[model samples]
Target: MLRIKGTIGDWPVDLTVEMDDADWARLAQNLPVNVAAPTAAAGATPVASAPVDQLWLAAQDLLRRSGGTEGPQLMSELEALAGSAGAAKGLLVRLRHSPKVKIEVREGVQVFNWVEE
Candidate 1:
């Protein structure tokens, strides 16, 4: 038996899950979105454009480095990053420290590029 509680958007929810290995496997396969971990915290904030702009820059850089690859894992990671605070509006700006770049089965790879205008 495992209990989990979290919030998505304005909804605060709690869950009590009891399952065996087989059940867990089935659940994992059935609901892949339910089994994602959050990204690490980027303390303070760097001077950057809006969250959307920052995301674009970061994504472009990652894509360039990754050779414009596309896959699932990368997409998921992107979603997580975007969902983080100040991501869409371009406020929260910080680069990944470790791995520098990682591969996502769905997303392929990261591609971010900062621009000056």
Candidate 2:
């Protein structure tokens, strides 16, 4: 038996299911796997996953647009734009050490602001 409870948007969802041994055995036979390939888009470079160069560019853009943003807020926006949390985290960590990056605290929250040279 499997049960799940959660809310999506405004509605609450509660689900329960009973699966026999045969049901589990059937699912084990073939589980879908995702496979990705790198392919060039127009004149752009081939990218299998989120490219570091583009991620950096987007991070800078966000800082410039918003003046400064909280770490978690920046991360969420990056994930939405780049589709990967790993890529966002990598960008933020590198950005934190860059001399061009400006960090400040406002209302007890750390903020990252881009410093233009």
Enumerate clash totals for all models, in the order shown.
34, 0
How many pairs of residues in model 1 come into backbone collision?
Answer: 34
Residue 74 shift from truth in candidate 1, angstroms? 2.6
lDDT for model 2, please.
0.63
- The TM-score values for the models, in the order shown, are 0.29, 0.52
Compute the lDDT of residue 29 as modeled in candidate 2: 33
lDDT of each: 0.42, 0.63
Q: In model 2, where is the ten-residue run with the lowest total lDDT? A: 28-37
Per-candidate Cα RMSD to the true structure, in Å, reads 17.2, 14.0
Q: For model 1, what is the error of residue 59's alpha carbon versus the real structure, in angstroms, after optimal superposition?
A: 1.2
**Candidate 2's residue-wise lDDT over 1-117, tens digit each?**
446699999999999866554553353234222223223569896554333444455566777888788988988986666556765555566567566778898888878988888
